[model samples]
Target chain A: MGKIFQKPEALADVDTHYCPGCTHGIIHRLVAEVIDELDVRGRTVGIAPVGCAVLAYNYFTFDFQEAAHGRAPAMATGIKRVRPDLMVFTYQGDGDLASIGMSEIVHAANRGEKFTTIFVNNAVYGMTGGQMAPTTMPDQITTTSPAGRDTDEVGMPIKVSELLAALQTPAYIARQTVIRAKYIRKAKQAIKKAFTYQLEGKCFSLVEIVSTCPTNWGMTPIDSIKWAEDTLLPYYQLGEYKTPNGAG
Target chain B: MTHEHLVNRDKCKGCGVCVEACPKNVLALSEDVNAKGYFPAKQARPDDCVFCAICATMCPDVAITIREIADQAPTENKGGK
Candidate 1:
């Protein structure tokens, strides 16, 4: 075997604290692999946000800054404004980006900040014990919505990529998943494009990763992947919401 | 036979799964810590490898790669490794 798959060198040699079958680990590896391939590991600066992946700063080999909950966009904006030469990105969760950080994310996209954002959407908050997230599926049971999320009561899940694509400032926006190899390959391509857009000085690149929360969903690791595919994909729909070359 | 090993010194976060994933007992915790100050995973035995890339595949980081050791010859290429 001439080494077909392994961890990328850009990642830190530490075990992830994410739950088994959690999509956070997969998303992180994808971003790190992108950095390695782009050869921007040395100049990249990632802003780590609150929620399950708040500790993401410890996983990547690049320089990192821990921002307040729902404040990663602001932090990344400031960093990029000051250090325009650096490749800046933010790693935010659905709870952090779609919920309280909603204002910041919207403004960042509106202002067209030249930064990359890896938005992990597991439909629920995974760090603070599986609470209902803004992206939570209709009737998806969570700690707050134990009887499943009622769309009539809780409203429908917010389509972040679609909403952001509507904004003219953002240069790239995409929604992808990591439940299987076929999707994973596409997600990697999307991630690489987002980074490439950022390197080209394009504005507001975001990759919304429809992820899995095995512990919160009350399913085994394998089952969680299946649930994400069967339940989440129908709503999220993996594809490029926006692209620099005008390709969707 | 070719052998594969994954190394993610910074991404290891000291999870120790690679050490357990190896059936050949070829992996061990490194004594030298990385920038994160975590003991990274290391190859305990390189020569005994049967080219099983399980350690690399099992890695959450996907940080390891299996390579064939060729003598004074160019390495074989793959589509993606």
Candidate 2:
């Protein structure tokens, strides 16, 4: 039979150790494919954050550096500065990026660090047992907010892409999801564009992918994807928030 | 023309899913184990190989690649003659 789907070469030969049906695998594949297409796999250095994807280095064949929680942006900045010739990218989750790392991300964007960031926004802290995050939506239930997130107590969900776009240093920023085929295609394009921006030596570029957590969300894979499409999309609309050339 | 399913013996994890997925009945679990000490998938009939990547697709460890051997210079070519 003709090929339908096959794993990319950028991924290691080991089976993913992530929980089955987690979107982390999909996001990893997309980044790997983009890296392969850019032909920068050898020169690329990815910073894996302190979250569920902390072990992402083992999944991909490229050189990977581990970063502290919410410190990937700063780490990436240093890497790119020291080795400007090497392609630097950071893979961070919502808690790692929008929560404790917010200051680093904001300053990195303000400085135009010329690096790529793949932000996985599952709306909850997957690594820390479903804790509420800065991007967690109102009325959303997490382990810390079992009664559902109350805006009055925790404040509102931060529109990260919009907030980052307000900074002048960012060259590209987009919010996309992988809940369905249509959004998956858009997410891939946004990821590719983020890498392209880095390849062109542009300022900080980020693509926040709205993903699902079936095990943590207490829903099946199908329901988790549906939840992201139904609840998260409305709060985090899909679009290019900022582009240097004014082209998405 | 000939086809061969080249199993990267080092990578196979003794996952029997591939052995159960192959439709041509050409693949079998090897009695000999690999460096990993797993029963690697092996071809029972090299001549009957159709290069179906089903085994590769089912292999979560990505230890398989089916390669097709191009037919050598045609002994008798109907179109050319």
Each candidate's clash count = 28, 0
Candidate 2, residue A74: Cα displacement in angstroms equals 0.9
lDDT against the true structure, each candidate = 0.81, 0.80
Each predicted complex: what DockQ? 0.22, 0.08
Q: Give a tens-digit lDDT track for model 1, residues A1-248.
A: 25456568888877777764466777888888899999999999999989988888888898999999899999999999999999999999999999999999999999999999999898998889999999999888899998999999879999999999988889999998876656777888999998998898988899998888878899865677678878999989988988876757
**For residues B1-81, what per-residue lDDT tens digits would candidate 2 score against the true structure?**
544457766666555546666677777778887876767777765555566566664454556765444656522311110
Give the TM-score, chain B only, in order for the candidates: 0.70, 0.75
Candidate 1, A183: how far from true, in Å? 1.4
Best by TM-score: 1
CAPRI class assigned to model 2: incorrect
Lowest summed lDDT window (length 10), candidate 1 chain A: A1-10
Q: Each model's TM-score, in the order given?
A: 0.80, 0.76
Give the lDDT of residue A128 in candidate 2: 81
Candidate 2 lDDT, A1-248, residue by residue in tens: 33334567788867666653577776887788788888988899999999999999999999999998899999999999999999999999999999899999999989999999999999999988999999888988899999999999879998889999888779999999866545666888999999998888889999998888877888855577678878999889999999988745
iRMS, candidate 2, in Å: value is 7.1
